[model samples]
Target: MDYIHLNEMEFYGYHGVFAEETKLGQRFRLTLSLAVDLKQAGETDELKQTVHYGEVYGLCKDVVEGEPKKLLEAVAEQLASRVMEDFPLIKGVRVLLVKPDPPIPGYYKSVAVELTRGIFV
Candidate 1:
C-alpha cells in the first residue's frame, strides 16, 4: 500500500460552538493521508489509475469552507467519510484538523483532532 499525503492545507472557516466564532470565523489547517495501491499507476503512469490529488483537495476545501459545523470532530468525520466515498480506490484515510487559535484563554499553540476511517489491507 502507498499513501498520498496533503499536509498543512490552510483555510478560513466558520465552525465553532460559540456564536462569535461562527460569525467571525477562524483559520484551520488540515492534513490528509490517503492509502491506496499505487502499483498500477506506477507501472502505467496514467492519471486514471490513481487518485487525482487536485480533486481531493477541492473536495476538502469545499467541506472545510462551505458549512458551519459546531465541532472539529464533525469536521474531521465529514472529511474522512467523503474522501472514502468519493474515491473507491482509497483503502483508508486519516484526517487531522487543527485550529490555530481556539477561543480558550490558555496559552497554547493549537487544538487539533485526528480521525481515521475506512478499511486497510
Candidate 2:
C-alpha cells in the first residue's frame, strides 16, 4: 500500500464544551494520512488513478467549517467517515485533530484526538 499524508492543517473553528468557547471560536489543526494503492497511478501516470489532494482538502475544509461540535472525537469520526465516503480508492485513514492554545486557565498548550478508521490490511 502507498500513503499520502497531509500534515498540520490549521483552521479556526467554533467547537467546544463551553458556551463561550463555541461563541468565541478556536484554532484547530488536522493531520491526516491516507492509505491507498498508488501503484496504478505510478504505472499509468494518470490523475484518475489516484486520490486528488485538492479534492480531499476541499472536502476536509467543508467538514471543518460546516458546524460546531462539542467534542474533538466527534469531529474526527465525522471527518474520517467523510474521507472514506468521498474517496473510494483510499483503504483507510489516520486523523489527528488538535486544539491549540485552548482557553484553559492552567498550563496547557494544546489538546488532541487521534483516530484511525477503515479496514486493516
Identify the leading candidate in terms of TM-score: 1
TM-score of each: 0.97, 0.94
Clashes of 1: 0
Q: When superposed on Cα atoms, how far off is each prediction in RMSD? A: 0.9, 1.2
Instruction: Encode model 2's per-residue lDDT on 1-121: one tens digit a residue.
Output: 6899998888888888998879988888999999999999999999999999989888888877779999999999999999999899999999999988677788877899999998535
Off by over 4 Å in 2: none
Q: What C-alpha lDDT do the candidate models reach, one value each?
A: 0.94, 0.89
Against the true structure, candidate 1 reaches a TM-score of: 0.97
Report clash pairs, candidate 2. none
